[model samples]
Target chain A: MDEAVSATAGARVPRTERGRRTLRLILDAAAAEFGERGFHEAGISRITQRAGVALGTFYTYFDSKEAVFTALVRDMSMQVRDHVAPRLSGTADAIAAEGAGLEAFIGFARAHKEIYRIIDEAEFVDQASFRTHYQSTVDRIVTRLRRGAARGEVREDIGEVHGWAIVGMNVFLGLRYGVWNEDGAPEEIAGTVNAMLRDGLKP
Target chain B: MDEAVSATAGARVPRTERGRRTLRLILDAAAAEFGERGFHEAGISRITQRAGVALGTFYTYFDSKEAVFTALVRDMSMQVRDHVAPRLSGTADAIAAEGAGLEAFIGFARAHKEIYRIIDEAEFVDQASFRTHYQSTVDRIVTRLRRGAARGEVREDIGEVHGWAIVGMNVFLGLRYGVWNEDGAPEEIAGTVNAMLRDGLKP
Candidate 1:
């Protein structure tokens, strides 16, 4: 890594603990503003005011509101990825572990419900970039399914089909009910989907 | 129904033939532009230009851009409901016919891909209305599944679970792959969903 480049990147700031705190403030404010008012309506000035930072200082950290949203999405995606990584690693059987896996997934969604909404709702904001960001996670999920299949857990008849099906199911459930509509809990929906997958969707 | 309200509501346009044609032109142009550039970016001026209507004339029917979008969604929803209604009339024993129902639904998606995108992307415009629109259709699908379960055509284990799973699968598949990314034909995705449901999701 270029230390000079890194230093230059940091030099815009005061190079103190306060600088880091201010950066965090801006990110948190940006996420909340984007989540509540949406991307189009959430202005940079509002974020600056919310962050309690000068507008120009926000520009020093993030070039634009779009950049802030992108960073927000990336941070949330990695959080979700990290949450699932370990639980998915040591499962005894693919079919058997699906229940626990799904439960954990739903638990994660509940824990980070707002972030999930920001990401899902982001698709309607900048479709091209949001699609790219979503697809990266989708690809990872597909790979995880494939890994399960290789380990003799997932059924092979319709791996790709089931892959997309499961992904689609999670996405829809998360978007429809998980994020904003807390009419029901996330685990209930996950349990419902798990049962459907386990026994086949006959009804 | 009041004949005046009925007539005006039927087309949401003036009774004159020329006015009706102009309204259709505006709706078509709005749909195209909305699909291409999304609701926020697609301007009223551009819509009038595309429809070959005066700016004042465009406002004669639609009160605002959102009003135009609402009209388009309403019209498209009616079109889809009409297209799917005939095929869904058969009894439960007619699994083949039910399969055809899935096919018909996919066909509607394929034919009106942009309209599907409009609905999928509507969250950015008016999320509550979009959810209301989709929730009713989901309720109809759940009703169908309940009917199948009542007739002993569906498994006894979990009817509602499977119902929502299938609904969720169809929706996101259509939204993600069919409407936006569109990697495969809607019929193919529909077929895969049907097959997975039929034999079960197991190996």
Candidate 2:
């Protein structure tokens, strides 16, 4: 987990602020390349060109195309966490926080629609990263659910299974409402799902 | 959708029972090849070898590798439906049927571990098939939910969003419980999710 901060998988850790900026540039460029062209067609030189950096600079942070894609997957995972964390912090009730988290995620997904393609493609491009990404996300949800349980905001016996279900619901809701089509406003969509979470779908 | 019965993504329809058996063998072999080696590295000859058919026989059905992969995705979708649908029909209570469906799905996923990889790869190999697989699955869920609503087993307003949310939950649960770890029994996992779905997660 500590390694996640400085580097992802085999990516080299940047030593300075400028170096970090260069790594970020490379990752952003890689996202666009991989997201649009996919892993097989996406090339290192094209990623470098898109990043507006030299090929040597890419080697400074990542050893190969696979390395950068792995790093990008990790970066996106963190990006999603960072984006939704603050919004959750502002919420007190666990259920309310879940709703807020979902709305914020929908907003994030809409803004970075390529996240879906990139993450889904990780299955073929880098299988380990793909597994890690989902495992980590579900772990985060389990932690939050346990925390909510301790505070009596959620069911006392809720555990990993519940976390997986919520994560799945949020992921699909994001896909349908955020990535595929913006059928409803993010808050509205979140509210609808939250209602179902708050009450059973019983008539 | 007419072509879906005989072919997937421009594949030729088989005319005879023998032809259907051959097509079935090819699809099963394609699933094995694509599921294990993925779309790019999975070769036609390998599929033919696995199916005990000649290369000409492979061509008699599928026009290309992409076509077979696409067909496999659709086939898996049907496989999932066929596996779960009968189980659902045996249960009278719609809510209870969903739990049965989930448990059956977890079992299917456990048995067909490569299913996750192959279906996920469809997003990259054939976008249309990928979309169709999920769209059709969610539609089936929507129809079931509406039927439940009519029977007063589910809420009347339970519609597409609920269907998508439930699909997402079931998919992720299958990934974790069935594919990744199998920490809990399918019945246990389904029971837990069904409970959350049956009642709100309120403390």
Winning model by lDDT: 2
Candidate 2 per-residue lDDT, tens place, B1-203, comes to 56456355456777788998998899899889888888889999999999999999999988888778877888888889999988898686777788999999999999999999999887777878888888888999888877877887877787778788999999999988898887888999999888877664221
Supply fnat for every model shown: 0.43, 0.82
Q: Candidate 1, residues A1-203: lDDT per residue as tens digits?
A: 35323322322444678877787788788778987788888999999999889998988787777777776776566666677667766666554345455556666766666675577666765555457555665676566656666765555544445565666666666655655555666567666666556555222
State every prediction's TM-score relative to the real structure.
Answer: 0.80, 0.95
* A84: Cα error in model 1, Å: 3.7
* Model 1 chain A worst lDDT run, 10 consecutive residues: A3-12
Docking class of 2: medium
Off by over 4 Å in 1: A1-23, A86-92, A96-98, A105-113, A201-203, B1-22, B86-107, B156-164, B180-182, B200-203
Error of 1 at A5 (Å): 14
Tens digits of per-residue lDDT, candidate 2, A89-197, equal 8686778888899999999999999898999888778878888888888888778767877887777777778888988999998988899898888998888788887
Residue pairs that clash (backbone atoms under 3 angstroms), model 1: none
Question: Model 1, B6-120: lDDT tens per residue?
Answer: 3233245686988888888888888888978888789999999998889999888888888888777766666676787787676344344445666676667766778756876
Best by DockQ: 2
Docking class of 1: acceptable
Off by over 4 Å in 2: A3-9, A200-203, B1-9, B200-203
